[model samples]
Target: MSRARPFPAAATLGILALSACTGPQSALDPAGEDAAEIAGLFWQMLAGAAVIWCLVLGGSVLASWRGRSLWQVATALKVILWAGAVFPTVVLAGLLIHGLRLMPGLRATESDLRIEVVGERFWWRVIYHRDGAPPVTSANEIRLPAGATVEFILSSPDVIHSFWIPPLGGKTDLIPGRTTRQVLRPTKPGVYRGACAEFCGASHALMALTAEVMTPDDFARWLQAEAGPAAVTAGPGPDAFLRHGCAACHTVRGTEANALVGPDLTHLGSRHTVGAGILANSPAAIARFVAHADTLKPEIRMPSYAMLPETELRLLADWLASLR
Candidate 1:
């Protein structure tokens, strides 16, 4: 007999790497109760399919055997009927009922915490709502208390976009002039990755964010800090910001930069990433982003400040970094 070809090592390694699925963004990890339920359903369906496939294949082989008799043919026909017809109908019905039962739990009714997320062309405008307090604005990062149900009211100002955090819950669409909502109750305290699941525009692939699940006490502290205004500092950066006509589209608390065309830079320094989570939040990164935001995220609305002098760019970056 001819020898079989050996499996390629490189291909095997690549397949294994893909199957790892250990990232924080993976739905298979299931960090929350809702995610766990979804994952369980997926596994159940997969197992059912495998069982049916094996039964059908085994019956076909047995029926085609050269020595098969009438008794074997009858048995194979019976197996095919049960595995292909009865089994599928029963499994689908069960799945449908189970999914319907889980629907109410996935919906948001009333929550102690609510967050409004507006989807822009390639970024996220986040607003935190608290009782008897002014709304706090942030961008590209969502912070929530672990073990508490939080509601997210989502909307889009332009094209349709979808908000999805795989380890927490399902994808919810953000349509222009229409509002949608999703409820999440994370059971783990960790950082999870989120992204725009819908194709909106050129920079849609780069429209990503981070969800930080923290303890109740820590979340309270963070919320309090975020509600406050940016710290005041004396620097040439403020004058340069206004000189460059940046105030017409951005906002900085306690300053005259109250325009709303872009994300609020009032607490920019406190964020972990910039350029819609495309760049790390550092002095050097900020400088590059300020000069070449369009280069980092193509087709963005922000203009490139590549014409600015090196010193002025550095000064602007420093000023933004000091906002925290």
Candidate 2:
């Protein structure tokens, strides 16, 4: 066999690296107002650093070219003093001022919508607090209206978890028994990924969420729909879900399965992911997750339903998948 082409391998690696620069989770690929500001600051700071680097590099080259001359040595000392200290201080101060100006916008408490997000062990609980309605409860997904400022009231019930959606803005820490806040204004209607930036436990890496930005009209309709109860409450799946004691932990509104120990599954089927983005939402995925919750997401509070019969598991999955 012929040896692999070195140039081709390098090119492939370069392509892979470049592909990461623009994606759903990239901070540089900003889709929101705050993110755009952050990206601009990043580029400006990078340029300042580059200028400092060039000045120092050029001075070093001059010193090397004019080696062993006392006059040139004095000149090099002056160059080092200016390039290594004065230039960096001024550039850093300017960048710091630019960065500080962004803090007020991020800290602005006034918003068109207020969302309370509670971080659990390996999942998220989302509650929308609209002005004229009771809070709407959901899980694992966040929906926002494009071009509107949204204030996220964040907290963790157990450990510290940093909630971050890089394409939207910076990370905010969620501490137990204390509330923190972050505000973001999305300018584009698109799908993005959010994650728990802090390490919580065995399944910390799997703690992920999806954020979808919609138009004002579309978001209002979705929120109205989400406020209602499950569409399928009398099916065999509901029966099986109750029979297996899943109701003790989960709540499917408009039915007797009301409990607050776990996430509300009233509209589980409507969501795009199951097990907090570990699997796509579908009957097969639901069945697999129901049958082996522990294996799918280790250390989660939801116990595995492996003891349930295969037929009942199918019924449960089908019924849940129709929840939308």
Instruction: Score every model by TM-score.
Output: 0.90, 0.93
The TM-score measured for candidate 2 stands at 0.93
Q: Which regions of candidate 1 fall more than 4 Å away from where they truly are?
A: 1-15, 64-81
> Candidate 1: lDDT of 91?
78
Candidate 2: segments with Cα more than 4 A from true spot: 1-15, 70-73
- Writing each residue's lDDT as its tens digit, candidate 1 over 1-324 gives 966556776788889987866677988888788888888887888897798788777767876884457367778688668866898888789888989999998885977799999999899999999999899998889999989989999999899999999998889999998999999988899988899999998999999988888999999999998888777544588888888999999988777888988998888888888887788789899999989989888999999999999999999898898888
Over the full model, what C-alpha lDDT does candidate 2 score relative to the true structure?
0.90
What TM-score does candidate 1 reach?
0.90
How many angstroms is residue 72 displaced in model 1 relative to the true structure, after the best TM-score fit? 8.6
Each prediction's number of clashing residue pairs: 0, 0
Candidate 1 local Cα displacement, residue 129, angstroms: 0.6
lDDT by residue (127-156, candidate 2, tens digit) is 999887799999999999999999999999
